[model samples]
Target: MAGWAAAAALLLLPLFAVQFTDGVNWEMVDFSVFGAMLLGAGVSYELAVRMTGSSAYRAAVGVAVAAAFLLVWINLAVGIIGSEDNSANLMYGGVLAIAVIGAAIGRFQSAGMTRALSATALAQVLVGIIALAAEFGSTAPSFPEAIVLSTGFFVALWLLSAYLFLKAASG
Candidate 1:
């Protein structure tokens, strides 16, 4: 119930922001997409909690969900590597793919989650390196620096999630 309430509050936030400023404009499609993402994250976390009795495992699930949510939100709102229209931004999807595939392969167990998230973090780093070397979104706003910072931030999130899962497995 709290998760559902939080989702509703977050969904309404944009509506309030739009009324206050032009900078916060959001169409129906934006609302729909964000709502779907939030719903999926909430559902996924709920299921994960059911699968684990460990607090560390639950925290890991929260971190993983939050990381995935932020990645999609930022990538869609404004291109991470450039503008939303930039083709380079699509590379970030690979990172999400790795996480998804890894999670499935690991069967959502703590040990498996640890490996999955660590691999996801490595994939994030590699994507950042490749984008920099290839100059994928050179024309986008904050081009190089923003890309570096975003990559670092996401990598850290993945690592943190992996560490939590590892702790859960150990404990």
Candidate 2:
């Protein structure tokens, strides 16, 4: 309940921002989509917490779920490496697809969740690699060094997620 409230408040921040400043330009569709995203994240997190018994496990799951939500949200709003139009951005789907498939096949058990997270982490690393290749292949790579560093961060997060899932499963 608290989480959902916080999510609602956080979602409202942008709405408030738009009214106060021209810098925050968002359409109805943006609000609708982002609201849905935040709602889903909150619900999913609450569910995870309710389902898990261990506080450590809950914390780990919470972090992983939050990271996943942010990854998808950021990808949709702006390209992680570049624009949303970037082909490399498509790789984010791979992470979700792998996790869903793994969960479905493994019935969302600990081993299954661990494997799913590990696969997602791998996909994150691959996205980074692809982004780097795409950037270098272009006329000249721009500042902020698209893909490599950004992808690495995401990959590291996924790896930590995998570790948490693995620990939860073992303990």
Candidate 3:
């Protein structure tokens, strides 16, 4: 109930913002997508809570969910490689696919989650490197720096999640 309420509140924020400022213009589709993402993340965390008593495990789940959510949100809003329309942004789907597939394979166990997140971190790095090599966003002023910085941020999140899961597994 609290989670659902929080989701509603978050949804309402944009609605309110739009009324107050033109900078916050959001169409129906934006609200729908953001709502779905919030619901998905909430459901994921709820499931993790039901599955484990370990705080470390729960924290790991939280971090991983946040990372995934942010990845999608940013990709859709502004595209990692260039504009939101850039085809190169599609490569991020594979990074997410690895995490989903890995989690399913591990059955959400702490040890398995550790491996999954570690693999995810590696995948994130590889994707950034590939983008740089292929010059996905080379036309942009930021280019390689933006790609490297964003990739590092995500890699750190994934690594932290993996570390938390490792702690949970060993605890």
Question: For each candidate, what is the lDDT?
Answer: 0.93, 0.75, 0.93
Clashes of each: 0, 0, 0
TM-scores, all candidates, are: 0.97, 0.88, 0.95
Candidate with maximal TM-score = 1
- After the best TM-score superposition of candidate 2, give how far the Cα of residue 47 lies from its true spot, in angstroms: 2.2
lDDT of 1: 0.93
lDDT of 3 by residue, 1-171 (tens): 987898899999999999999888899999999999999999999999999999999999999999999999999988889777889989899999999999989988999999999999999999999999999988888787889999999999999999999999999
Please give, for residues 43-140, the per-residue lDDT of candidate 1 as tens digits: 99999888879999999999999999999999899878878887777888999999999999999989999999999999999989988999988876
Model 1 TM-score relative to the real fold: 0.97
Off by over 4 Å in 3: none
- Regions more than 4 Å wrong, model 2: 136-144
lDDT string, candidate 2, 27-143, tens digits: 999999988888887777777777878665676667667777878887787667677766667778887788668767867566677788788888877767766765632433442
On a 0 to 100 scale, what is the lDDT of residue 93 in model 2? 84
**Model 2 misses residue 115 by how many Å?**
1.4
